[model samples]
Every structure is written in structure tokens, then in C-alpha cells.
Target chain A: MTAQALHQHQPHRPEDGHKLHGYPPGDLAIWVFILAELGAFFVLFTVYAFTRLKHLQLFAEMQRTLDSDAGMINTLLLITGSWCVARAVAAIKRNHCRASAHWLLAAIGSGVGFLIVKYFEYGAKFAAGINLDTNLFYTFYIALTAFHAMHVVLGMAILLLVWKKAMAGGYSAQDHHGMETGASYWHMVDLVWIILFPLVYVMR
Target chain B: MGVHFLNVIWVALMVATVLTWLIGKTGELSTAMVVAVLVISAVKGWLIIYDFMALRRVRLLWRGLVLGWLLLTLSIILLAYWLGIK
Candidate 1:
């Protein structure tokens, strides 16, 4: 579709003087979903924080056993992935489909890197016979990180689909809503990890 | 946003991540250290929400919702930390 045709389809608000202004980019449904997801995580994080207050010593000691280096690496990976996904959206907005696809692939690569690092980290814990029942700390640690890792998996899958579509010239500067939606989800995954790393591994 | 601008943001995020890691490595358990780490995290989260997520240019409601989420979550965690310290 031409840019003119795209603009016609979009609802014109008085505040939306420009195409990209007044409303959040991408589908409105995705933003609703993102807010719900963030709400869920907020509850989980709050629970973990207050619970730690009750058993500070156990939480701190267990935190020490965690590999902070691995956590740091994963944080970097997710941040890099977010950057690539952001670039992908930017490229698509400019009608650079090929570059957008390449950026999506790069984001997926970073996600894969994160999962691999997490796998080893989990492997070490399992080898040491750690399980959900180990203690309150390990339970929260395992549950929280595992939950976040699952989101990473889902985010990468979304990116892969976006990448496939981009490679097929399915997106253009005139309309790339799907690409923006996927990028938004990927960045939320990264944002969550930004807090998780410090709360679980670094913060005393 | 321009590609160059995105690159600059990426570089800033990287440097901040490294600083947080170094603080973790120091292993000095104090209230101040915790506050420092959480503050750094809030900044990182802000950049991701506004820049990478492209919410900076959107309506205030959207931007405020996400940023509000970040602030409230961090504040609750900080309160819990303070209680623990007490």
C-alpha cells in the first residue's frame, strides 16, 4: 500500500499531527498485552523482595552461590538483542527490508546466546543437586529465572517470525505494524531482565 | 530516531551494564550499594522503555504507564530493602 493509503486506514486524531505521534506505535492490542505482562512481573518481583526481608541471611547466602558473571553476560546479551530489534524496526520504517531482516536475525542470535548461557548456569545448579525445594531462596531463584527465560524463548520465536516476514518483503515504510509489535515484545523481555539480574544476583 | 542516535544509546547501555557488574563483583554488602545498583537499573530500564521500545514519542499515557510501572516496582523493592536494613 502507498503511504497515503496507509494514512487513510489509520484513525486521525487531532493530536496525531504526524503519522507516528499521539498513539503508541504498533497494534493497540500489543500494548495492552505488554502492560498486563508487566503487571504480572511486578507482583512476582514484589513478592520476592518482601520475602527476602523475612529471610535475609538465607537469600543473601544463596545469592552468593549464583554465578553473577553469567547473569551479567545474559544482561548484556538481552540489551544487545533489544538494540538490534530496535534497529530492525527503524530500518523497516525506512523501507529497508533487507537490513531490517538482518537486524532481526542479529536479535535472534543474541537471544540464542542468552539461552545457552542460562543453560550452563542451570546445568551447574542441577549438578550440585539444587532443586526447587532446596530452600526459599533457590525456589524463588529457579522459578523467577526460569519464568523469565521462557519469555525469552517466546520473544525469540516472535522475532523469528518477524524476520521471516521481513525477508519476504512483507513490511515497508508505509506499513510495518507487525514488525513494531514484535520489537515491542522483545524490548519488554530485555527490560524485565534488567531488573531481574540485579534483584536475583547482584543486589544484597 | 537516527541510526547514529540508536548506536549512542546502545553504547551507553553497555557502559552502564558493565558498571553494575563491577559493583556486584565488589561484594560489599551495604544499603548504599543496593541503592546504587537499583538506581542504575532504573536508568537502564528507562532507556530501554523510551528508546528501544520507541515509547518516547508516543502519547503520554503509554509512556507514563510503562515508566510508572518501572518506578513503582523499584520503589517497592527499595522499601523492602530499607525494612530489611532496619
Candidate 2:
């Protein structure tokens, strides 16, 4: 509220952080979508936990049969990707477009690596004569992980677009919604994987 | 110390995995191990969300949203475990 601040150039569009007043509508949308998503996943997880608990011995047996190593490695990869994305955001804010591009690419690449690892893990499960229909526990394992895998795919796509937009100068130091959106989605992927790793892989 | 730090987490995670297996194998350690696993996993989950999700810097409401899900998830998991044994 400076006396000389009456001539500020306000952004009319709502996509950018500056609106007529308060936060951008897009940010609100993203938060609403995120909240809704958490609710959906919460419901799914509650049901999964209930069923797994109802069949604890079977779930434990199922977990005992699966390999935990692969899951651990995937966890490491996604976390590294998260670090890269964070650096990307920092670089973008610092006006280092090229460096930001590299970080976004690395984030996308690591996301791909995560999925590749997931494929191998799933492939091994299938190869070793295990599947969703085999038992109640496998049903939850497959369903949850498969849903997470799909999110990973979606996140990578968003990251790729972020990379492209950054290169085209679609974002400046002051306005980088694409980067923010990408990181938020990527973190969602990482969060889901965190739950998946312990619940589906380790806890049992 | 940054790279070294994340590397340490990587190591800690590996060790936790081995420790989980050891506890699982000990049989006598299963119940305690299960509780330990849940607690350790909760810590590790926060590491990922705060360090990785970039939630540490955001508004408190954002952190609250993530934690809300975690608490719900934990309570349900406990209920499920209890039901399975009963």
C-alpha cells in the first residue's frame, strides 16, 4: 500500500498469479482438483486397507512372495526426480532458462526411469505366476500400483510440456505457472509412490 | 552437504529395508517390527513429501492437506490390520 503504487500493471488474465485480487483462479482450480484427488485416493486406500486387513495372513503371504528390492529402487529414482524438479523451479525463478530446461528434462527422464522400473517389477510379478485374480491381496496390490503407474505416465507428459514451454519462452522469471503445475503434479506422483512403497511392498 | 545428505537418505532407506526383513524373519519381532515399520514409513513419507513434494516452504494449509490424507490413511490401515487379525 505504497502511496506511489497506484500505477502498477495488473494482469487481467486469471492463469497468471496476479488477478483482479487474491490468488489466481487456476491455482484455486489446481488446489480443488488436488483436494478431490486426495479424497478419491483416500476412499480407495481405506477400502484397500480394510480388505487387506480382513485377509491379513493372505496379504502377508502375498507380500512375502514379492520382491522388495525393485520397489525400493523405484522409490529412490522418483525421489531423485523430485530433487531435480525442485532445482528446475529454482533455476527458472533465477532466469536461467537453459538450466531450467535441463532440470525439467532430467525430471522427465527420471520419471521415465521410474516407470521402466515399475514395468520390470510388474513383469516379474506376472512372470512369477502372480496376478490380481490370484488372491484378495494381489487384487489391491495390482489395482493401487497400476493406478499409480498411470499417474506417473500423466506426470511425465506434463513435465515434457513444461520443458517445451520453458524453451519457447512461454514462461518468464515472474510467471512460470507451467513449472509450478508440473512440479505440483510430479510431487503428487511421488507422494502416491511413497504410500505405495510401504503399504504395498514393505508393510505386508 | 546437500548431495551427501540425500545420499544419506538413500542409505538410510536401504538399511531400513534390511532391518524390516530382519524383523520379519525374527518372528518374535513381528509385532514390534510392524509398529516400527509403520512409524519409520511415516517418517520416510514425510521426507518425501516435505523434501520432495516442496511442501515444506508452502503455506500451512497445504501441509495440512497432505497431513490430513496421511492421518486418514494411517487410521484406516490400523483398523484394517486389527480386523484382519480378529
Candidate 3:
């Protein structure tokens, strides 16, 4: 479908206005889940910040041992993945199933790239005899990142399912709630990393 | 959002990511630098929440909830930094 055709089918009429204005793009259940996930991360982030206040020197010293370059690359990957997913959602809304599937595949590829980088990073740290019990800083570093990495894995799985559906022509302009739901979850993953990269890697 | 606008946001986000990376690489520990990094993070989070998450057209309550999460989280981090400097 052309852009003009897609615009004509948009659910923006007076009757649909209430629907668009009331909730977000995805399902209410997904939004609830997102809020719960964010709440958990909020607590973890707060604890890390306050804990750093008590051991500033320890955090500063241990942080130096980290590879900021890898963190930056992971940030880029997640950001790109997010953009691709957004593009996928946009494509599907225009009833372009093939294009949406391609975009989703690209997003999944970015997720794979992130995992590869994170794997090497973890390998290097373990090679240096560093473990969760290395110290307070290393403990937080490993725990926090490992937790976030788990979320990335889950996000990729969700994306994979969405891709399969998109490829099967399961979604269209009037019925893409699943795509938006998955996209929202993926964006949440990216959102957490946006804060995690700076709080854990950059901020001294 | 249009694909073109999303592309623009993607480029802007990449630039901001590189800037944050450069700032971290400088290895200068100062209050100003810390604030700069946190502020950059806040802006990035806002973009993801509002634009990428497609919350911009939603009700004010939902938008406020997500934005509030970002603001509150960053504020706590900033407060911690302030306490550290004390």
C-alpha cells in the first residue's frame, strides 16, 4: 500500500479519536508489564547509585577496568535495533508486510550483535579472574549487566516471534496490535540500557 | 511517526551516544561532567519513551507515568552524586 493509501486507512476519525487518545499504541496488558519492569529496574538503579556514594573510590577504580568502547558499541546496537523496530511498526501500519519483516530481521540482527559484544566482554573479565565476588563494584557491574543482558535475550525472542508473524502476513494496517506490543517491550529494553550505560559505565 | 523523522531521530541518537562515549573517555571526574552525562541520558530516555514507544499521542497520564519514571530515576542518581561530592 502506498503512503497515501495508508493515511486514508488511519484510525484517526472522530469515532476513533477516543481510542487513540485514551491509551498508548500497544495493549494495556503490555503497558502494565512495562511499568512493572521499569519499577524493578528503578529500585536496582537507586540502590546502585546510593551504594556508589558509600564506595566512590571502589566504583571509580573498578569502573576503569571496564571497556567503555564495548558499552558504547552495545548502546549503538540497541539504538539501531530500536529504530529498526520502529520502522518495522511503521511499515506494518502501512500494510507493507515484506518491508516490515525485513526491518524486524534487521532489528534481530542488531540484537545478535549486542549479544556477541557482551559475550566477549564477559569472557575478558572472567579471563582476568574477575567474578561476581571480585568486590562491590565488580559485583554490581556483573549483576546489573547480567540482568540487563537477560532482558535483551528476552526482547530478541519476542522480536523473533513478531518477525515470524509479520512474514506470515499475520498483521496489517488495522490489526498490528501484536507488533506494537512487541515493539513497546523492545523499546523498554532499550530505555533501560540508555540509563544503564551511563550509570554503570560513564558516570564516575 | 514517519520513517524520515525516525531516521533523523536515529542519527541524532547516534550522535548523542558518541558524545557520551567521548565524554566518558576523557576520564575527567568533575561535577559538571557527571551532570552532563546524566542529562544526556535523560534526554535519550525521553526520546525512547515519547517517540519510539509511541507514547506521544497517548493520554497525558500514560506519558506522565513513563516520563516521571525517567525523571525520578535520574534525579535519584543526581542526588547520589551530590551526596558523594559533599
Residues B1-83 of candidate 1: C-alpha lDDT, one tens digit per residue = 77888999999999999999889888856889889988999999999988899887777888999999999999999999999
lDDT of 2 by residue, A95-138 (tens): 78889889889988888888888888889889988887988888
lDDT of 3 by residue, B1-86 (tens): 78898998899899999999999998846899989998899889888887788787787999999999999999999999999999
DockQ of structure 1? 0.67
What value of lDDT does candidate 3 attain over all alpha carbons? Answer: 0.89
Q: What is the Cα-based lDDT of residue B81 in candidate 1?
A: 94
Candidates 1 and 3 compared: the better one by lDDT is 3
Off by more than 4 A, model 2: A1-26, B1-29, B82-86
Which interface RMSD values do the candidates have, in the order shown? Answer: 2.6, 6.1, 2.3
Question: What is the lDDT of every predicted structure here?
Answer: 0.88, 0.69, 0.89
In model 3, pairs of residues that clash are none
DockQ for each model: 0.67, 0.32, 0.71
Order of quality (DockQ) = 3, 1, 2
Model 2 clash pairs are A53-B84
Model 1 lDDT tens row, A9-127: 33222234444566566667667788998999999999999999999999988998999999999999999999999888878777789999999999999999999999999999999
Runs of candidate 3 with Cα error greater than 4 angstroms are: A1-20
Off by over 4 Å in 1: A1-20
Between 1 and 3, whose DockQ is larger? 3
Error of 3 at A38 (Å): 0.4
